[model samples]
Target: MTGEDIYFAGVGDVHGEMYEMLGLLKKWESRLSFVLQVGDFEPHRHEADLQTMDAPGKYRKLGSFAHFYNGSAVFPYPVWFIGGNHEPYGFLDRIANNTEIATNCYYLGRVGTVELAGLKIVGLSGIYKEHLFEKRPPIEEIDRHSNADYIGFTENEVLQGLEFQRADILLLHEWPRGLMTPDNRLDVIDPEMVGNEYARMLVDSLKPRLVLCGHMHRYFCHQIVWPDDTITRVCCLAHTRSGSNAVEIFRLSGNRSIESLRSLDER
Candidate 1:
């Protein structure tokens, strides 16, 4: 879309809180160009689909996704999301990557890219698992393995992500390694286990202007300044259950530079 400025929203893990998530964005719906969600969306169509997810039973209840999928409820704006550790593989695997699963809700797939509002948005779905790093079975064969098999991004996906020379925004489900330092370490998590190296590699390679991630269910912001003095801002969002800190708003100028960035949770 051509415009002097484009406004949009970025959200962290929904974890099946679809109605609540949508409610929070309602105030900005008319002004937003679109919405980006950083995985763990859990768009289960029904109880059967919810059963196929890899999350613990306690966290496995089907949320409001079916309402949107069935057209009983409509999304206020276009929504794009990736796959996280807790997702309905049974339903999502049936659909091709980068395809719209619902009216205005899209699945960004394991590795996918799209241009929206004069911005190139690239996404990598799923978390990093050492054993699953080297292999990515075809979607058709996904049913042959456990849900865990499709929960980690593979090397092939990373290679696909590298194909993009640059991106305006990079969407990931997990944080990139090296974000945690003495200045930003959280008391609850071990510094060494904060993020994954593969994600860090993508950030280093692609050098997107903005990197968005969620999975740790915490709010964090960091800037990685390249040798050339280019800065890549990384924002990790908390779960939607946590309220305002889970969402942020951004406005990009016509020249494709970020004009403003703010958290919806900000007072």
Candidate 2:
């Protein structure tokens, strides 16, 4: 990599294991420009905050977010993330979109766009649910609703995401449809139940060079070639429990095109 080359890390679903996630990325922290995490990060500040997350009681440990929140542990690099099905909605709902939730940490909100290292990055948080697709109650009413109420991406959010003309990288919590073919089918995930149509539409419309996602807790890579020969690379990552498979690194040139990409587990 040259001085003009930008290196960054993309992390999979954290599921509240902040300490483990940080440890996994420690080796590359000094070289990375930033870290982008796909959702289910679960940055809860306290027990009350954990209650607002949509997860089973057994899976709801507070993890390590509170240490970061209380200034005990600082993030090694700038971390940007979208929300997943599992998140602290009670606390995040109180803040505005793209707001910094902690020092050097930012939440990309329901639909967000940001420019980084000369690349246009867009993110759409949460999974798609047909019943909740068109529903978005006022933010003020978020507290009154159950934790499950805020887990899905609304139709309005998807429409808002479509406004971006193009993107160098698109962040999503779930995989897009059409990624699974007979050659790449995994016994762990059903071919028909793996991805969502809205996400596929976003990829086809925005035509981003790269798409990063988590939620399914499995690592897979696929490429979509448009009629014009433009290619979009999609990488689905596993959860933190899978160790190195949950993280991937990318090196981009000054021109904002990917020069090299590899998963931590490659070695």
Candidate 3:
């Protein structure tokens, strides 16, 4: 925990739109310390992996990260991400534990934490599914097309989240169930947009100062009051799309105080 303010930007569901984020980062480069992309990261390591995952023929063979991985272009600042259901699990499985892909870009494992600048960030990479909790497809079996494409945690992975004592922030791929406050403008408050139970359990146990997620593809903010009476702010960011409010920035003062939260790109 440091006294100085920690500045960072967060975006969600890039869905292979890395350049769009890079452009937004450029607009706010002077003020940002780092950027976090919540999910739908789509890191297709090799063209063949796309086919191995049984992706549609029409789906692009290359991922946005390919350019960064090949050193053709570099992100201006460090970018960290977790995986969503649409990602290439075969590639992610190899470097699932805080692997750095580009000069300053990283994948924050299925269940782990990484310290960036002065903030401690925990990541829970997949979404939640009740049936998959007890048993999930092995990375190899995930290639089958008939099975549901919803990425999720095995019981062991959910248990891993319980090991963390605390964190400055929690970057999750999906919103936690029953945490949102109703706002007519935001769909995340609706029951249909509610996220998974495993995530809620982790939030209940870890109680991080802040939680960020985006699988619902909408912007929302809610205050989470834990059983102990502590409160955590959860922000559900929008997906990356043209003219979307998908990029948000925040300043963490001291260890847990949020000094500011605002859009990174004015548009």
lDDT of each: 0.87, 0.87, 0.75
Full ranking by lDDT: 1, 2, 3
Deviation from truth (RMSD, Å), model 2: 1.8
- Predicted structure with the largest TM-score when compared to the true one: 2
Q: Put down candidate 2 lDDT per residue, 190-239, tens digits, no spaces.
A: 79778899988899999999899999999999989999998898989899
Clashing residue pairs, candidate 1?
A: none
RMSD of each: 2.3, 1.8, 3.4
Query: Candidate 3's residue-wise lDDT over 150-214, tens digit each?
Result: 37766798788788877778888988887644443344335745788888888888888788899
For each candidate, what TM-score against the reference?
0.93, 0.95, 0.85
Clashing residue pairs, backbone N/CA/C < 3 A, model 3: none
